[model samples]
Target: MIHPVAVIGAGPFGLSTAAHLRARGIPVRVFGEPMVSWRDHMPEGMLLKSTPAASSIDAPQRGHNLVDYCDAAGIPRLVTDEDIIPVETFIGYGEWFQQKLVPELERVRVVSVDRKSGPGGQGGRSGGGFEIKLDSGELFTARAVVVATGLSGLAHLPVELRGAAADGPTPTGPVSHSSQHHDLSRFAGKELVVVGAGQSALETAALAAEAGAQVRVVSRGRGRVAFGAPPWEQPKLRPESPFGRAWSLWALSYYPQPYRHLPAEARHYLVRRVLGPLGAWWLRDRFEGKVGVREVARIVRAEAQDAHPVLTVQTLGGRTEELSADHVIAATGYRVGIAAMDFLGHELRTQLAVSRGTPKLGAGYRSSVPGLYFTGLPAAASYGPVMRFVCGTEFASPRLAKHLAAAHG
Candidate 1:
């Protein structure tokens, strides 16, 4: 029971962090299924907005990137910026990465994580240690814990659509979040209304349309649905960045540590405005003419009428209209809130400080509670929007692993 570190996820962040930690001669245990979110949560036929080079999970070990996986697996490589990655390919790459770097990864879920404080308990940290309860009914102790659960419990639903059912959104209900759908073919021949203009909303609409469903997308009217330009279409003046060719994006993508120094207001604004609702360049061709996009339209009310979802929508200019659909899908995207992490025990949850429902992380993504770290979506509030993407693993994994190795020793 000399486990020094426990990683509570097996996504890109978790796998990368564990790989780095193990590389540093640190004893660690990783929990959760490999690439479960991308494989199970996101709908099939969906392509990642990130380019191939940006989608790789970084680690201390060599030959574990997406390109390496493709090369080893004898698959054709799409190395260009315009080459959009498919969800299936990404999932396969992630699994390969896990097997090569963190093969001992446990597929069980971590049910509860709580801080256990006592002297000389399991020879963890000097003062106290952490107890982790797995879904398999086994208990374990570790000196530190890293929470890299990507997008888990962070799905957001608009208030107007929440009233469609008493029990809330479901796969068979009148309203459901886009993350709940693994296949859009079920919506075929049905009248579908999708809200939001982000990649998820636009792509979900496109998939539903391709599945023979009549799809209509509703935007809040704050901005129009836009698409990222290809490398050639981008301006030549600005240098390249993982996000785009802008200096601001370049700075955000490369140096996420500086983001914490800015005023909270500025940081929050950039997070919301930088990577706003937009579609991938490849998605435009499939989405245009195939799906109906209603910008400047806001859903004011939603109700289930005769087992169907009906929405009263209003335009920015004050015009109101009602639209009825067989089902409503809220592609509103994720909202990071620490409270959504129901796996944290009450005592530990109370001790971890938070701001705006997200952990106020310090150096190395550590929460207020010592030895407890959080990354991925939960770290976005402190690390900027770059942490919202897979490329962030390059910046966070090494730093976090180094920090944990030093802290535990």
Candidate 2:
């Protein structure tokens, strides 16, 4: 059967896309379990880095906002000066959105998507739809596709860590990325070392410390940085109000041409300056003294030593030290690459044109590959860094729905 649109990855972006498409009277088949990544990967006690107001799914009216959901549920509507929104709350909010607004989603995994041949050759018709092949061997055609498989599916671990685990069964002590960490009980009373200084790294370290493990964090940079407080200008920036402060920032910061004009070094520098050094306020009190932060150090190598792993690390003062730990946790971020997706057939994966390892997306989030489109973090480079945040759906959903409607109409 042919649907007007097929939305992949049932996270916040995918569900939002589906909701908007449905609202536009377009038929959409959404795949994957709702909030699967958030439910499985994130630690239980972790709080959201952003606020409820800033982290909302794109809805037409203000009635469905996160603030309203919290109020209806009798949960705290206003955040404490120290407390950021918890991950559990955000997940609940997502579930609430899915149940109330977007309920027509099918929990299936899409293995591959290929362009179909039409009556004419090569390029095919401009609006010709494409086919999606599912894991259950089901085939469905759609004029457009939206890829919202978020950060959960694509984690980046160190090369040495991957090689060690590849030789045999993955050891309980060998898990590298934060996405792989589920339970804290396993590391109790053990010497644990965590890498990276991002929010994930700090949170994981704190959890490990709370689990009674001897925890140490090895950071290549200075230290964990955090945002001072929920910026007062955020509420005024909602996308619904075009002339608001948020929209103005979005216009200046997210527009492609201006961002592209900045040198890569400049962009990195700006991100480090503005968004860097920011973490949840609660984290500072929990991890400050308990989690040992080793700055200006790099893990040069890692190898199994006496049935455990020992890392050769270089400190900022040009001093070399070897530290042995019972377990190592790498909170390193994700690698966005089509090569990592084994489900894609060689031909189809290669055929899809890419820009800096991400699928090149049109104005409507549709890729050069007719039916396939990519959203979320992968779209950030093209659409703007805001795409990496949940707020991006406000812009992505409506624009994508219009494209699908035009193609199917």
Q: Which predicted model would earn the best TM-score?
A: 1
RMSD of each: 1.7, 4.0
Per-residue lDDT over 1-409 for candidate 2, one digit per residue giving the tens place of the 0 to 100 score: 4446778888888888888878887777888989998888887777777655458888755667778778877898844333467788888888888888778777778888766566553322354566789888898666676778888457877774553344532336444667876676678899888877777888888988998888988777565434243344346437522112355455733454355346555544443343344565557788877978677456677777655777777888888888778877878777677877655567768887775566666667766766667878777655656676787788777777777677555
Q: What TM-score do all the candidates reach, one by one?
A: 0.97, 0.86
Deviating ranges (above 4 Å) for candidate 1: 119-124
Q: After superposition, how far is residue 381 of candidate 1 from its true place, in Å?
A: 0.5
lDDT tens digits, residues 1-409, model 1? 5666999999999999999999998988999989998988899899999888789899896778888888988888868897878899999999988888899999898999987867754323675678889999999888899999998888888788887966877889999999999999999999999998899999999999999999999888685878878678988999788878889889899999989888888877888888889898888899989999787557788999899998888987889888899998999888888788999998888887887888888888888887899988789889999999999999999999887777777
Q: Please estimate how well model 1 matches the true structure, expressed as its whole-model Cα lDDT.
A: 0.87
lDDT of 2: 0.70
How many residue pairs in model 2 have overlapping backbones?
A: 7
| Model 2 lDDT at residue 214 | 87
* Predictions in order: lDDT: 0.87, 0.70
Task: Name the 10 consecutive residues with the lowest summed lDDT in model 2.
Answer: 236-245
